[model samples]
Target: MTQPPATPLPPPRERRRLRESKSLSQAQVAERVGVTRETVRSWEAGRSTPKGRKRTAYATFLASVEAEHAPAGTVAPPSLNSRSAGRHGSAPLTRSVEFVQPPVRTAEPVNCPHPTRPPKTAAEAFDRLYTHTAPALVRQTYLLTGRRTLARESVERAFQLAWQRWPEVAVDRDPAGWVRAAAHEYAMSPWHRLRPSHRRPEAPPADAADRALLDVLLSLPPAYRRTLLLYDGIGLGLPETAAETEATTPAAANRLLHAREAVAEKLPVLAKPERLHERLAELAGAEKLQAPKSTLVRTDGERRTRFWTRSAIAFTVLIIGTTALTLRTAPTRYEPVPAPGAVISGVPPQMGPGPLSQADKKLRATLRGSGRGGPHRLAPEAG
Candidate 1:
């Protein structure tokens, strides 16, 4: 028999939203669907589609989930075929299936005042994002680091970075998330410990319970603390928390578990995750963690970019100048020079004529005595 037509799956993003709404992790979904977690990820990311039996299984799972979460009186359209019904023991699938669309609210004007128009310029877009997200992000950073100044600084810096890369940030799926990750990284940087200002701890919350919760949170490792904040404090799904924390799903789960246990051990009242989340929100809200103005952030980012750019140019020019000067002053040709003469030692001095030899002295005396003409006469008589 011919295989049943492929199941009509929801859009990739919708599939992920459905899973997360059901509080199901990729690993959990993968297990139930008899596939690897990577396979499920690929399917959700639209990198690949499930085929044959897996396709039907995945579609069935998503449809059932959607149906369960659908509003009252709404139903998910059936996409299963007769072959699928026979295998699952459901009613025989019909060829024609109609999808049910939710009722649209038309009472409100199409141009509502609340939803602002899209930003026309990059600066406007960046400012809009900063204004919308900075306040909460500052508070979140405060919870992450427990330093008010650092919290505001982190948010400001993260926005500056975002402004610097506006093209990337504007097109990002979650600009707030991009900035949040940057802020979290800056707040938790190991280098911050070296600063004299950060060397001392910030004051604890005034309320006893708030103080206690903050202490418990700060006592945990930074990784564990961040995981708890993202998962419990921010209500992010496990995959999202893991992705934010740069960890695997299992690793994020482990961190969350350990963090929760630590918090609960210290503060029994916050044993429940929900209670912990509430306490965290309360503590963060109580702080005076205000972010800088969006205009200031944008200006600072531009100023910082200019400063670095000019500094780089100046440094390059200095290097070029120094190299040119060296080349100009350097010797062009080789010149050889004789070494200075040194005194020779260790030779016997010449004896002053060593007293003229005795024979030479006698001949000199005889010549002097016979120098007269008598010597010449005596020589002639002998000839």
Candidate 2:
């Protein structure tokens, strides 16, 4: 006889719900399913689905979990074994297999209702995102840079960039995350070191423990520091932290490990991950890092855009005018240059009468004697 078709898995959301209802962590589920935690996360996130044996195993695990926690009076859906038993006139299996049916394939499109209303305008949507995300982002940036001014600047700049590219930002899976990454990159930029204002260090937190913690955090390499903040300070998953920091999962893990080790070495009290998370939260909360108003940010971004737009237009116009002028005035023909004057190769030198020799004296006397008749003789000769 052929084996029954593998039991169909529930929807991703339902899969996550069932796992959570059973008080299971992704790691625990992954351990049971012989996959990595990231794989389990992906399954729940709807990024990818399991296939073959993994699919059957995952379905079985979720089904058993649902059966255990399901209400007493609720009717359960039939499973493969249950269907088999019923075919043989045996008692139906009691376990609930009521996985939500997957959406039916259809030739025509269907318009499912959205859970929330869309924002009225792009500005309104951007403002809502900014208001919701900026405060927390500022604190996180502060933790990264250890400078309140830089943190606020970074967040504002990030939001400005997001607004500049609102279309892209609007469709992003995690807009807040996009802005956060931007802010983090700006705050951690090595260029900030060259700024005169940023040359000096910001004052440490007032509390000794906080100061020590912040010091230790700043002491870690920028990559390690960022990974630690994203993972421990902000409580992002390892995979998400890796993705945000642009590193391989294993590399992110290594950074986190080394960062934690460095912190624990400096502050033994925060050796535990949970304790470190708490301390980080406490440190961030203690600061008065407030983001600028969303309206101000939006307006500033608009103003900046306008300024640049006008500048670009003016620059283009100037370039066009200059090119036209050059074309109009430039000579069309080549002209040959006149050659420079040169001196004669050979010439006789004139001598003064006083410096002349005896021949010169006799020639002068003869010329004086003949001078009176020279004109008359030359005239007769001509006639």
Candidate 3:
């Protein structure tokens, strides 16, 4: 009978045959390859693939099989150590290789999104989101740190950063959450920490009395202050707070409650916002001062709206002015002229919406666990 024609071997099969020919088991080949026997078995069955550095690794294993089988007279003389060393990136064939195979590893790294997050010029990102977020970030920070100047500076720096990577960050699951996180990071920066004047902030609003309270709150560790603000000011739930602050839900809740108790015990003045401001102011006056010029976010909404509105209007006028000049100087009068100022006067229109719509507000409020029976009350003794 005619011998069956020889078929060229696949990579895995070739590797496996090399082992079998050397009288080595799957486990032995796996040991040479620095992998488990199951991996070798999978390779033999063609149930898996090995690529990249691992491909070189497998080739090295086959080379080792050839060397081991040398005593058995199966390996061809010329096709021995020389070829394997070159393929395995080891020393020249004159020297022996001490093979160290890698163990089977599937999860090697965290899947970072940075590579694919769109490349954004930081300035472009800031220009897109700064106006929308800077004010709230500033206000929230001021409330927490009691340092209006530092808060103002902190928000600007944070938003500046956000702007730098706007495309990448805005596409994240929660852009606002990113803003909050950025603000926190900014608050902890050396620039913010070094400026001592910002520690005792101007009292919130009209309260001269809240200064004392503010001082006490500001004196707490940063974690406590952040926990307090996210809980008391942002009204975040425990789990939501955990996601924001990088804590477990129970930990976040306990932190909030603990911080609240600490603040109350340390400075009872916060029970009344007015008194809190006054006390902080007194503390500031009594403390030997470090006078860094601070930026304050003292303006209320209408002022901010006017400031941005004026800016937008001024920008429009400049654009129109430039366009008009371009049209006059152009080789053709047919170049499209801009419409009158009235058209774009309504541009960006107004602040329009707040954090969410009323419907969304209700839904979020509903999700807040109903505050049912006020957290302390049990369910009517289960009837």
* Candidate 2 residue-wise lDDT, 37-68, digit = tens: 77886787677999888998999999897676
Give the clashing pairs for model 1: none
True lDDT of residue 116, candidate 2 = 27
Q: How many backbone clashes are present in model 2?
A: 0
For lDDT, candidate 2 versus 3, the one ahead is 2
lDDT of 2 at 77: 18
The segments of candidate 1 whose C-alpha lies over 4 angstroms from its true place after superposition are: 1-115, 336-383
Task: Supply the global lDDT for candidate 2.
Answer: 0.71
- Top lDDT model: 2
Go through the candidates in order and give the clash count of each: 0, 0, 23
Better of 1 and 3 by TM-score: 1
lDDT for model 3, please: 0.51
Pick out the ten consecutive residues of candidate 1 with the lowest summed lDDT: 93-102
| lDDT (Cα, tens digit) per residue for candidate 1, span 250-309 | 788789889989998989998876567667767866876666777888899999999999
Scored against the true structure, residue 76 in model 3 reaches a CA lDDT of 21
